[model samples]
Structures are given as structure tokens and as C-alpha cells.
Target chain A: MSTKDMSERPTTVLQSLNAAMHRLMAGDSRVVVLGEDILDPYGGAFKVTRGLSTQFPDRVLTTPISEGAIVGLANGLALRGMRPIAEIMFGDFVTLAADQLINHAAKFRWMYNEQVRVPLVVRTPMGGRRGYGPTHSQSLEKHILGVPGLWVAAPHALGDPGSLLEQSVALEDPVVFVESKVCYGRFLTRPAELRAEEIRTARSPFPTLHLTHRGGSPDGVIFCYGGMAPVALEAVERLRDVDGIRVDLVVVAQLSPTPTDHLEALLQRGISEVIAYAEEASSSAGWGAELVATIEEIRASIAPRRSIRHLRIGGAHTPIASSKEMELHDLPSAELVAERLLECF
Target chain B: MKTGERIPLCNRDSSPNELYGLMFGIRTFEQSLLDLFQRGVLAGTTHTCLGQEATAVGVFSALNLELDCAFSNHRGHGHFLAYCGEAELLYLEVMGKPGGVCGGRGGSQHLQHRNLYSNGIQGGIVPVATGIALAEKLKGSGAVSVVFLGDGTLGEGAVYESFNIAALWQLPTLFVIENNGFAQSTPCALEVAGSIRARPEAFGIPTTEIRTTNVETIRNETSRCVDAMRDGAGPRALVLHNYRLGPHSKGDDNRDPAEIRAAWDQEPLKVLRERLDTTEVQLMEAAQTERIGRARERALAAPRYEY
Candidate 1:
């Protein structure tokens, strides 16, 4: 491995998203942005859309507090040959626009027999760490995970947000591009081999990254993305240093259309146990449940008859509390992740 | 379907026979669906536009079919037929045949044929239509987008939000409110508070109200309004005051039968039939029934979806 460039740090997720929007708007005249409180100065609640209105005043629209209308408007724009990226201020507010997204935007292409292409991108921030309470701090992407024809792309801590978003904007299908609230300011670091060149050139519907522990054969693997990406890495390092156990980390950039190829390939590496971590609540049927089912189905066809143990670590199944302690208790911390891995082993 | 200039109903190529033929097609098709439901042929219930044919035919007749688009509400059979005019396709869709518009996935409420889209959700299509208009304005296509909204949809906040944006952006959108007396089982008087036209008017959109069920007059006004929109007049609204001649759904008839009978007198078909020859109308009705019978046969013969 090459020496780390400590002086040179990677761009943050928010910066990457901002840069991606700017690039997309600059490249295509049909690219338009709409969101509540997305005007200049305020930019947005999270400021991911900062400087966009200033650069593209005619294209950037400041919408009212109508999530349903905002998404539907984007769909109309897409149908009219314009690519629109709608920003739902918070992930939880996506429930208001569920009717449009689930029914109209997702089903427009197939429902119309592929005569129309709805290239609408719905960008929203998910996950909570700053004690934003129950409404604001939720990983609600799982609720929409199973929606057919909808692509959900979540950026890891070190994932290329600009490239993922650029690909999302160019997609013919509707995409639910999720940005982690906690990971917006977090710096992205990757192995020396996984450079920016390869990240920008990724064209798959689902892009995955594999980081091994010091080039050693992995004892296990942890599958995660977005806010949990950093936590999984931390857990990996703790296991290697404290317990002398080496594990691999897999970051899945795409959450929907289920990334079956990349996942099956990972399982084909013949790992004995796989651990999945998510920021979503521990619902009965979530991304983890789907992932486990897919892994089990693929595992049945393996020649060696490998008995791969699948474990999951997710957020507590309760409303996020306001207090710092309760907030920490609600989210799956790195300590808890490492402890869970150790217990499973 | 021709663009550029507005065409008046008198100068248009459509004769009364064709117009009545279209109306008769929708009425008979919906009647057949009701009969099918009663005879245990159909599985689910459907909302029918039995009495609101003129509103769909009139407004749709004014649109440039090749350029302008439309979004309809639950009672959208008339709207879909008015735009596409394919009775066989509508039958296949309603009968869950693979030859349906949405390949049998979407039934009566969820109809999509070319530029036409309809869903069962109230007020959901408003924002989508506004966006379509926004796209039209941005492309400088001079094409307008029309949303067929029910009085019940007015209760939804998203509808007003779409109105505000459509007016604010000067989008060429037309909000056609089919203000049939009752929203499902609830009466408009009990559900809606103020005047229907006043709602869009507050958003600075030009509002038009048609009290009579005259198809020619409705088409004339719609053409004039559509021409104004094409001339960059921004968003406008029209409230077609009408009544439901049948129950809300197959097994939900909370409305008084006497009120329905009274409404049947003012129904668009009856109102428009008064202007046409009685003998010709009877022959047109017979032809419409035969056409619907052929369509039903084709739909039934078409491959049904297994899943």
C-alpha cells in the first residue's frame, strides 16, 4: 500500500453533492432544481443546494412546503424532457410525497409501456446524530427500498458523491439519492489503489467498494453504506488492533434494484460470516432482511456448501430521543458495532 | 390535434353524430362494466363518469392532442376515452387483459395512454400537471397541460400549492374542476367551504364557470381559454358545475335516488340529446351498444394476465 497523504484530504459529501449539482446544471440546460428554503443565503436547511440558485437563478426554484407537489412537479418536468432534481428538506417528509413517487414517478415508464422516461432525481438527507429528534433524525430510505423501478443510491463516507449523483442525473429511471446528514462533513479516505479516476468511471447501477484489513485475508465482511460507512470502518480497525482479528469492509453505493451481481460476487469470495449494518430502524422487513434473504438464496448454489452466518446491526426500533445520551443509544455507534461483531464471532 | 391557431366548434370537422357517438361510447362502456360487476365477471369496483361526459369531451376537444397533455382523477373513463378514443383498449385495461393500456397492471382509475394519465388519488395530479406545464413553458412549446380535478381534491393542500406555483411561474396550466355535487359519498356543500372558482382566483388564475351542460358552449369556452394560455396567459381554471347520475362506486350509493333521478334530467347526454334528432339519437345509441359489444368481445378474447 502507498503512504497516506495526510495533508491532502478528500472532499466532504455535502461539498461533493453541491459540486455535482453545479456540474449537472452547467452541463445540461434541462437540469432544474426545486426545493423548500433552497434560495440564496439560506441555500437549504442543510445547505446542500448552496450557491446553486446564485449560479442558475432561472433553473433553481424555491418551492413552498409541499413535498407531494414538489415531487409531482419534478415528474412532470421529467416527462416534458427536462431532468429535475427535487430536494425533500428532510427524509421523513418523503412520506408526504409517497403517493407521487411510489405511484407516478416510479411507475410512469413501465406503466406507459416505456414510451416516457422519468429522469427525476429525488435528493434527501437521512440519518441523525445531532439530536434533531424523532422527525428529522431517521434513516427512512428502508421504507422506500422495495419500490420497483426506483433506484436508491446512498454515498459512503468516502464514496464519490459527485460521480454517483452525476450518474443518477443521467439515469432514465427515477432515483432516490440519499445523503447522510452525519457524514456530510466527514472526510472520505480510501485505499491507495481505489483512486478518484476509478470512482469517476464507475457506470454500474450499483457500485461497491471493498477495503481489506492491511491486505490480509478477511475473517469476515461488514456490508454498510452512508452514515454507517465510517462506523463500520472504525469497527474493522478496532477488531484488528484490539482483538487481532482481520475483517473486510464492503460499501454499497446503490441500495435498490438490489445490487445482486456485486453482492453475489462478494459472497463467492467464500467468507464464512457476513455482517450487515444500517442506520435504519430495526424493522421486521428492512434492507437487512432483504439482504439476508438474497445472500441465503445465493449461498444455496455455492459448490463448497459454505455455511455463511449472516448477522445484522441496525438502529433501535423506537423514536429517536432528543437527549445526547438517548441519541447515542438510538444510533448504532462504532463501539456497539464492534461489540456486536465480537459477540457474533 | 392541429396547433398554432384556435379552432371554433362550428368550424371544426366534428359533427353532432360523432360527438354523440363518443359520449354514447363512454356511457355504454361504463354501463357494461357495471353489469359485469353485478354478474360476477369483474372483481373490483370502479368510479364511473356517467353524468360528466361533456366536461371531459368538451375540455379534451379543445386540447391539441399531439402537443397538450392531460391528467385525470378517479372518475376518469370519460377523460381517457375523450383523449385516446380507444374503447377496446379501455375494455382490455378494465378487464385485466395483457392488451390493456398499462398491460393490465392499472385498471380504471390508473389509466395511461400516450400523453394522458389518470390516478385514483385526489389532488395528486395537480402538482404533476403543474410540473408538466412548467416543462412546456420552459421548452417554449406553447402546449398547455390540463388537470381534471374533483371537488374533493380541493380539500388537499397540495392542490393549492400547485395552483400557487403554476400562477407564480406563469405556467400554461388549466385546472378543470369537475364539481359534481358529491365527493364520493360526501356532498360538496358539506365538504367544500367557499366557491370553487374563488379558490383558483385567489391564486391569481383566471377562473371560468359553466353552469349549463351545453357541450358546444363548453368546448367554445375551453378553446378560448386554451388559446389564451398558449398566448402566454399563464394558468387558468374552469369549474364545470354538474352532478353524478349514478352511485360513487359499484356498491356505495349513499346519495338519495330521488336526487340521482333529478340529476339524470340535467345529465350532459340528455341535455345534448335535446339538440339532436330523436331518430338519429336512437340509431346512434344502437350503434354505440354494438361498438361496445365488439370492444367487450375483443377485450375478453385478449390474453388475460395470470399473475
Candidate 2:
């Protein structure tokens, strides 16, 4: 197939992640995959790790239901010169592995004084569209964003998650690769009416994907990431078509390190009047709060005199209910995003 | 010894003098650390392997240091010294000097030198070592991963999880439990329940229990277990029923003075010193004392870790 045909072909986010694993395992002997039920036939809970065990049976380890040990074991493999991608069955279980990730994997290289490098990636699905209830569905990446040596990357459906997964595996530091569960079955194609450009920076390997209307500059900008991209895009379209309000959307792939340089550069490029930080997690102390803090810091230097209107949008503080209606009501939606963006204006 | 030099395996044919020298060196190094702490020359806590020297010296001496990986806990001075014999570098590391093994960043509890690693947390290294063994198994390297845990760490749920995975995967791992009768100040009676051997045995891992301070016996048994692991016999556990001669860290002894005094009779140094000649033992002691003194001087003279 030609490059254009391949790019235009409809691929699900799940397929992209699976292909990323296959490519990584095929190209590098050091790369290994380990998780519960990640073997052939089962392919994990979301099927993102499908066919990996059949392809690389020896390297693809189907571990017991031990979240802490799974991550801890991956840290050991990474320390001993192997590129290991460990899967926590769900993003919520990542709390069980927090000690291994935060204390051991993240602190190993620096604490060991550069005596070792942990090229480890921990992949997990995070989001609440299905009725998986309180424990299984949570956007807990915020808990680990403040870690000194760890990297956090969340790939959206519109971007190439496969390449982002590969990039995360290639990094010298340990990374928490958060995949949105809601985006698994979605097609990995950008909308035709929107123009997308990947903004690259030296600070992070993953690029920030900027999406805007085809012909005109947007009156406001909405910064979202991972699964929130689709919701934000829907909101953007509704704002433009129904209310005649044009708003651009920025989808961030790398959540940690705050992507300050990219956000600063975008704001400096005159895309700053009305902004909204939308996220799938809770609003208090969530990724949106961090981004708002970062934007506030950026605005101090870039536009000290001008008052930039901004709003933070996220899920409610209560535990996500199992009912689909309540779940949708709790989480950020297209209508909510539009209403919040109007508030920003 | 130079960095990355192949460490000689301690076996039956190895000299008693050499083995004694290793155990004695560890004892001396830890004693010097205690002295340094008392003089306010060292910051942070130090877990001395004063009475448990035989386990470290014996277990590390048996493993092929070039390929095998060893994971240790907070009381890891003896293990580090036994694995690499880098007393001077360890001294520098404990003193927070730039010339230390991990550039003075790891301080006393955390250390990494080639295949040997250590951390301060209890029971966390179990899964880490199991994972290393899994890596070695995957690479077909025929190397066994060994982890040292105290009696106190048996209560951690992660240890059991690691035991289950190590047995389920048949990874080449050896879990060495140094049951020094106490976890910090809590006795094993208060912390551990049932038989410790039955724990790993429940996971289908064959275990051997040794209740001696004899370095030779411990070394011989560890070698046997390591050999079984190399031959793909799966994970094994070695329970060393030893005692802690010194306080847990610094001046934190809660045990009876009589118990501590009685345990000194079975200390590795005194036990091994009985086998050697009086003149030879005296000469070895003096040499180790002077060598350790010089290491401390050099470590003190070295500049502090900048960052």
C-alpha cells in the first residue's frame, strides 16, 4: 500500500496500539510485554494487546493478577537491560503499582546516580464511558504527573497512538502510557473539516496535535487530551455551527512536564483570547488544573498587561456511577464543553 | 579489587583464610561505620550486618558474580562488601563522598554496582529480583537472581505475590531470608507466623533451612540451590536462622543485654576465628583494622557529592 493509502485507511485505536506492540517486539529483541490476560485469545481487557502472545510467545509474558509485582517485575527487567512494557489491567489498578512505579522505577536511575537507566513503559486504559463503575474507570494520571523522573503520555484517536507508544518505549526514563478506553474502537482519522498540525518540541518526544478550522482563525482555543479530544472536537463543531462561534482545539499527547514550551509558544503566536482546559479527570488538582496553572505562569510573562479569560472543565468530584446516564452526566461532554467555552468568552 | 573485576567463587576448595578474610572485612567495615556514627562523622542511619555476616558472605561467595544478580535490603553492607569486596568505595558511598559507588547519591541503604542492587524498602525487592531472574531466564544466561529479606518482611503481601510468580514462571530466583530473630525491635514471634519455610513451600518452591552461623555450611547450601536454579529446577528459598549482634540501626537495641551477649558466641567472626591459628587470626584482624581505617581516612578526605 502507498503511504497516503495507509494513512487514510480506517484503523481503530486498539489496532494502532496492537500494531505498535507487534512492531516493537519484532524490531527489538530487548522489548518484552507482560500483563494479566495479555496472551493470545484473551489479548487483555480492551484487546490492545491482542495477538502479541502469539507473535512473541517467549517475550510476551502472561502474568498472574498481581498489579504491583507486574510493574515491579518490569522495573527489574528494565534495570537489567530490557525494554519492558507492562500493562496494568485497568488504569485504576495503577494505584496498587504506585510504589513500584514511583519509588522504584522512577527513582532508580537518579537515585543510582546514573548507574542505570529504566527504559520501561507502563500502559493502561483510562476513562469512563462504559459502566465499569467506581474502581475500574478513573483518570488517575494526575497522581503521577509530579514525579521527578517519570514521563506521562496519553494518545488520542486522531493522532497516531502506535508511533507515540513506540516513542515512549524508546525513551530512557520510565513512562506511564495512558490509553483512553473510550477511544479503543474509534477510528484513528482526523475530521475532514478540521486541519491538524503536529507541533514538535525538543523537551518531549511526543508532539502536541493542534486542530483548527479549515479557513479562519478561531475566536477561542480549547486544550484537551486523550479521549477528551473527540468530545472537545464535537464541542468545537457545535460552537461553530450552532452558535457561530469558532474555537480551535489543541490535543496534547505528553501530559507530564506540562508541555509548557508548546503551550507558551501557541499562546505567544496570538491564539490566546479565550481558553478552556478540558480534561476527562476531575477538575480539582487534575490535569486541567495543572494546565491552567501552567497557562497562568505562561501568561505572566507573555501577556502580563492583558486579561486572558480561561475556564477549567472536567468530571465531577463524586465517584463515577456505573449507570451510563450518570456516567455521562458526571464526565465532561460536548454540550458541557460548549457551555464552558461560552463562559470563557 | 578493580571495578568490574570477576569475583572468585567461594567453594570447598577455597581457602579458609580467604573466606575468613571476607567475613572479617565486613565485620570490620560495619564496626568502623558504627564508630563513625558515634563520632558524628556520618549522617543518616546504617543497618549493620554484624551478626548476619555469614549469610551475606556465604550467599554472595557461592554465586557467580559476573552473571548472577543479587538484591539486598537496608542491612546490606555485608552483602555489598561480599559481592564486590569494594570496601573503600562502600566507605566512600556511606560517607556521601563523590568517589562512592553510586556517586554518594544512594547513601547507606540504597546502592547499585553492576549486577548488585539494594534499596531501603522492606519486601519490595522480592518482585524486582524475581523480574531480574525472569530476564536472565529469557536471555538463556543461566544466571540466578538472589534477594535478601528479613523476618520482618515476610508479612508484606508483595513477597508472597513474588513467590507465586517466581514459582509459576519457574524463574531462576533464590529468596534468602535472614531470620535474625528481630525486625528492627519487634521479635520474629511478633511479626512472623507459622513456619517461614512453609511460606515459599506453599508456592511450590523447594526450600532449605539452615540454622548455623558457619560460613562454609551456608556457602555450600547456597551453591547447591544456585546450581539447581541454573539447571532449570525453578525458584528456591534459603532460610538462614541467624542473630543480629548489634543494634538494628544506631543505638536502637531493645533486646536483653544477656541475649545479645550470648549470641556473640555464635557470631561469624568468632566462629570462623576459632578455625584459624592464633597468630594468623591476629595478623588478619590487624590488617583488616588498618585497611578499614585507611578507607575511612580516604573517604573523609574525598570531596562531598556535589549534586
Candidate 3:
């Protein structure tokens, strides 16, 4: 009933995701799996899609290296009353399919006056660790935020993933569901239900949407999302131990639609200037641009006196370095966050 | 009559003439669009489906109202109207006004409206439509996706990529190349190196080549493709030999209109009209014309698509 009890049993993030996919496959015939190296033998590059091919060999489709084809195929399938889940081997590899996403699926609904329902999910492994540098380490959230027809998802917890994943499939729109390579091992947390209900509702979280721990304090707030959320949380620990200044954490599991309501409230509660944005993407786009733009808009609308500051530490220009230590230097890590926090202090 | 055992595209008895009437409807639909273009109401350039109307109207006829999906190119109003009931929004789209399907942002090239979607980029909609076909196949709903591309699109690597997947998986898709003889003034002869059928057949798909001018031929061949896909036959390719009445767009008129003019001399539309009994075919065709005439009057009467 309680999250404490749930984590007592050991399980990998892949197991939880596999269970969700299994349950989803049972729930609807429209559900299909697609990706490279996803078959009876290898499962997938990281074993995430392992065993899927065996159970639902018919539904699990193995595709070629063409990113455009994979993405376009998913879009077409979704339009034909089927729920398709497409996987790009690497998050960086999806750039090759930009034509289908940025052009077709994303704009279809708006351009066509809601005549087409792009009910498909694109799931990929993103973020850096183990030296996957520039190309591999990129967080493409900003690039997609501007697209009108898509629903963006970045599930940071195991239990929450169930509801999020279910909702993503049911949504009558295209979705980009991302999983961080680094945060996968951590135990997932969800709410406790009573002795009766199956907890059938997929929209709301267990009880409250917020989770409180030593991870909560409000000297300042760090609003980060995707792979960078955990880093921001760790940066809080670094700030308190080193600078003796406490900070609060607000991680956005969803990037698009920008969570305007939650963000507006956090800033209103007497937090200092906001941090512009982070992660390994270009400066002109992504959270950095919208993060600061939101701050500026709220400042003008709510408080004229307050001003938010920015310190950006993102992916380097070169290809994602394969060497582990060099990879650490390539992405903005805890140290970079500590530096930014101290400068603010 | 024989292009070597392969059925000649101009086989009159092989196609469905009634379907030609519908393509005629789609043809005038394109003409209406062109008229709007000439009036400066519709913005951007378009690839009109004038001579290729049979392909759109005929193939679209094979679909179950909401079951089948279509992907179109820059030249796309005919395909857009093939699915009934949203013709007004299309008018709004080309007009580039607020009421447009994409709220005017997509304009002509990015035309879409739910299940019926299309893009202007060459070979852009091909792979995407093939994906839709794959989804239909996976869902087991017997749904199919049809992509209408120009012969010019053969140059894109993405099209070839989708072609491989569709044929390999036997996804329920049909790729219709409106071989309008020219890809923007460059004849297909100048652009393509080999025959169209051999290209797709090399990928393990069954290919059908038809002369779209003969509506009956278009209807029969495409109907077989759709039925075969729905029955789990995988994918099929349709290569249409059609010609444009004018230049690629409104500006270029370089063609020696002689062949087209001679073809028009046969008066296909007039002949179809004659074949119809005075009551059934004549009434329907005339009524169709009358309805469109009134539509034109109403369209011009309405507040123009202009700001």
C-alpha cells in the first residue's frame, strides 16, 4: 500500500517499463512495438525491449536503420486507428527523422483542423553518462516544445510512469516519451491505494502531485526537467554543504505546454531570480529560452521588482565523447550547477 | 495494346467509368483552386491534379469513408476533397485566412485535416504515409494508406526507404505516382533512368501501371490493390501514366500543348457525357456541374479568403 513497501522488493527500471508495456499490450490490440535490435534474440540495445518480441511477436516489429521510415511508419499507423510505439536506438539518432516529426505528425492536427489523431508514442533513451557526448547526450526537448500537435513526456519515477505511459497512449495526439539513461536504476515512487480500488484512473498521481523529503527547502528554486532534474536535486545538496545556503527543487516531468501554472506558483512564493535553463541543446532553443521567457513574463505580470538570473551549462559542441571521464566534462554536471548556485548566492 | 504482356495504361474497358465522373468532380475542384489562384485569393504555388484526377477520385472511392487515410503533395486539392464534407475548410486553407484548416500557418504546402494529411515537400509524405499503412497492418483493422506522389519524387532516398519497408512488411499501402510526364518542366524521360514498375518490383512488391486518362483502368487496378492489402496481401505499387494540361504551375507554359490539345480533341469529358443515358449520366453530370457552379457563386459571394 505504501511506496516504502513497494521499493523493498528489488526491480530494474527496465522491468517496470516492461511490465507497463505488457499490461498495455493486454489492454488494447492497437498497441504495437517497433525499433532496431528489438527482437527475440537481442531484445534491444539496453535490454529494455527484451522478451517483448517473444510474448507479442506479432505486435513487436523490427525495423531498419531509417529513422524517417520508423517515425513516419509510426505516424501512419497511429492515423490508421492503431497505437504504435516507436523507438529510436539513440536519442540523438532521432534527428534524422526530424522531417516526419517537425513537419508531418506535429503539425498535422493543427494544420488539418483536428481531423487527424496522431495517437502514437515515440520512446527513446536520452541524456549522458558513460561518455556519450555531444550527439548522444543531447536533450531535444526544446526543439519539440514548439510543435503544436505533440504531447511531451519525461517520466522520472517508476510508479508515476504507469499512469504517465497509459495517458500518453490514450492521448489523441503524438507524444515524445523520454527516459534518462542515468536515472533508470533509482527506485521508483508512487502513491498508496486502499484495500479495494484497482486505482483505475490514469490522469491523477497517487494522492498529491508533490513529493516532500530533505529534498525540499526554499532559499531558492531550481526548475529542471528530463535528465537534468536529478542533477538539480544533487546540486541542492552541494549548495547546502559548500555554501550553507538552502534551495528548493521543482523538476518538470513534462516540458511542452510548459507547466505554466506550477511554474507561476513557485516563482510567486518568494524564490529569488529563476535559473534560465539547462541540458545539452543549443542556446537559442529548449528550456533555456522558455525558462527565462516564462520568468520574464511572470515578472512583468505579477511582480515588476523581481528579476531572474541565468547560468547555462549544457552539452559541448563536439561529438559525444566515448571515454567516461571526458564524457563527464562534456555535460553540465553537479559541479557546474554548484558554480551557478554560488554565483547566484 | 500491350507494353509487353503488361496491361496498356489506356485500356478503356479495364477501368470504372463512373469513377471517372468523380475524378472529373475532383478535376473541377482543382480548377476551382486554380481559379482562386488566378484571382490572387489563394497563396503559394500548387501542383494541380488536373489530368491525374482519375487517380485521386478513383482510389479514394475504394476507401471506407473513415477507414482509409491519404497523403498528398504540393499539388493536392483534389485529394483533399476526395473525402467528402470538409471542402469549405480547404477553401479557407488556400485562401490563407483564419478559418483555414491549419489556421493559415500551413498554407498550401502544409495542407492537412485530421485523417487526410499531406505536405508540399517532395517525397515528404511518402514515408509518413507508409508508416500509416504499417500501423494499419499492425492494428489488423484492414485499414490502408494511399500516398499520391509525382514521378519527380522518385529522386528522394526517403521514398525508396519507405518503399522497402512497405513491401517487406506487406504493410497495407499503395504508392500512386501521378507520372504527369514532367517533373516541373523536366520530362520523366530526362529525370528517371529506368522503368517505374521495375523499381518497386525490385523491392518485392507487385506493381501495376495504368494510363489514368482512361478512368476505368485506374478504378479496376487500384481497387485490386486496396482489396489485396485489406486481405493481408501486403503492399502494391501503382504507376499512372498521366499528363498535365498546362505548365507545372501557373507561370511555366513551355509545353507544346499539341499532344494535350489533340487528346482534348477526343473530348473525354464530352464522350463520357454521351455514354451516360440522358437521364442517369446526363442528370448526374449536369447536376454535379450545377452544384459546383452554385458553389463557385457562393464561394465568390462569401467574404473572400483575403484578410
Local distance difference test scores for all models: 0.82, 0.88, 0.69
Tens digit of lDDT per residue, candidate 1, span A60-103? 99988889999999999998899999999999899999988998
What is the Cα-based lDDT of residue A127 in candidate 2? 88
Better of 1 and 3 by lDDT: 1
Root-mean-square deviation (CA) per prediction: 3.8, 2.5, 6.7
Query: What tens digits encode model 3's per-residue C-alpha lDDT throughout A1-345?
Result: 254435577665666776788788888888988888899788888666778889888989899888888888887777667888888878888788778787777877666655567888888878777566567776666667757666677776523555567777888778888877776666664333211111222332211133223443445656566567657656766776677777655556666656666556555655465463556554555566776787779877888876667655566756567788887777778778777777776
Worst 10-residue stretch by lDDT in candidate 3 chain A? A193-202
Interface RMSD in Å per candidate, to 1 decimal?
1.4, 0.7, 1.9
Look at candidate 1 and give me any clashing residue pairs. none
Q: How many backbone clashes does candidate 2 have?
A: 0
Model 3, CA-based lDDT:
0.69
Name the regions of candidate 3 deviating beyond 4 angstroms.
A1-6, A157-159, A189-217, A273-276, A282-284, B1-20, B57-69, B80-116, B256-288, B303-307
* Residues B145-238 of candidate 3: C-alpha lDDT, one tens digit per residue: 8888788999887888888988878788889877888889888899988888888899998999875465555667888888888898888899
Candidate 2 chain B worst ten-residue window by lDDT: B1-10
Query: How much is A251 displaced in model 3, in angstroms?
Result: 1.2
Q: Which candidate is the best by DockQ?
A: 2
Best by TM-score: 2
Q: Candidate 2 — which pairs collide?
A: none
Question: What is residue A343's positional error in candidate 3, in angstroms?
Answer: 2.6
Number of the candidate with higher TM-score, 1 or 3: 1
